[model samples]
Target: MEFRYDKEADANYVRLRHEQYAYREEINTERRIDYAADRKPIGVELLCASEGVDLRNLPEQDAISDLLSQHHIKVLAS
Candidate 1:
């Protein structure tokens, strides 16, 4: 899996595989789930990053850490 933060867009995307999205489901105001043509979840997108997902913001303090531990996330350090 790959998570990328686009500084210019202030958004983050998590891609599990390079599959064409059949449709996107807005899980919430800021999160979207991307599904492949086969109806499999292939990716996720977060609209606003700097506010919603502070490295310190997850309800569980270690949530982000756990996630990063499982996959590769590219966040350019400022």
Candidate 2:
């Protein structure tokens, strides 16, 4: 998995794997899930990430928590 933050976009993208994009599921205004053709989640996009990310109710929370810690990004409780 790869965690990337775009300063210009103020978004954080967690790439779960390198796969073809089948479609995306919007979780809310701040979050979206990218899935492969198999319906397996391949990535997660977090908007307005500067405000901190809420790990609650998100997929792969454990891994994302670790990533956020490594990047020093604030993690908010939803």
Candidate 3:
């Protein structure tokens, strides 16, 4: 998994797989879910960065941290 942030777009993306995305859906405001061709979830996109995701209440923050703990992932924030 990977986390990418775009300062210009103020967007954040959590990539769960390196596979190409087949479809995307806006689950709600400023949030989109990406799926692979086989319907497997590939990742999630958070638009407007801070407005889209609250670090204090991130639903998957713990899960992501746990995954990152298994690997050497460099975190960046602005």
Top-scoring candidate (lDDT): 2
All candidates: CA RMSD in angstroms?
A: 6.7, 1.2, 6.0
Model 1's alpha-carbon lDDT is 0.61
Off by over 4 Å in 3: 52-61, 65-78
Model 2 stretches with alpha carbons more than 4 Å out: none
Give the higher-lDDT candidate: 2 or 3.
2
**Least accurate 10 contiguous residues by lDDT in model 3:** 69-78
Query: Clash totals for all models, in order?
Result: 0, 0, 0
lDDT of 1 by residue, 15-53 (tens): 767888899887667667788999877776766666654
> 68, model 1: CA deviation in Å?
4.4
Give lDDT: candidate 2, residue 15.
94
lDDT of each: 0.61, 0.89, 0.65
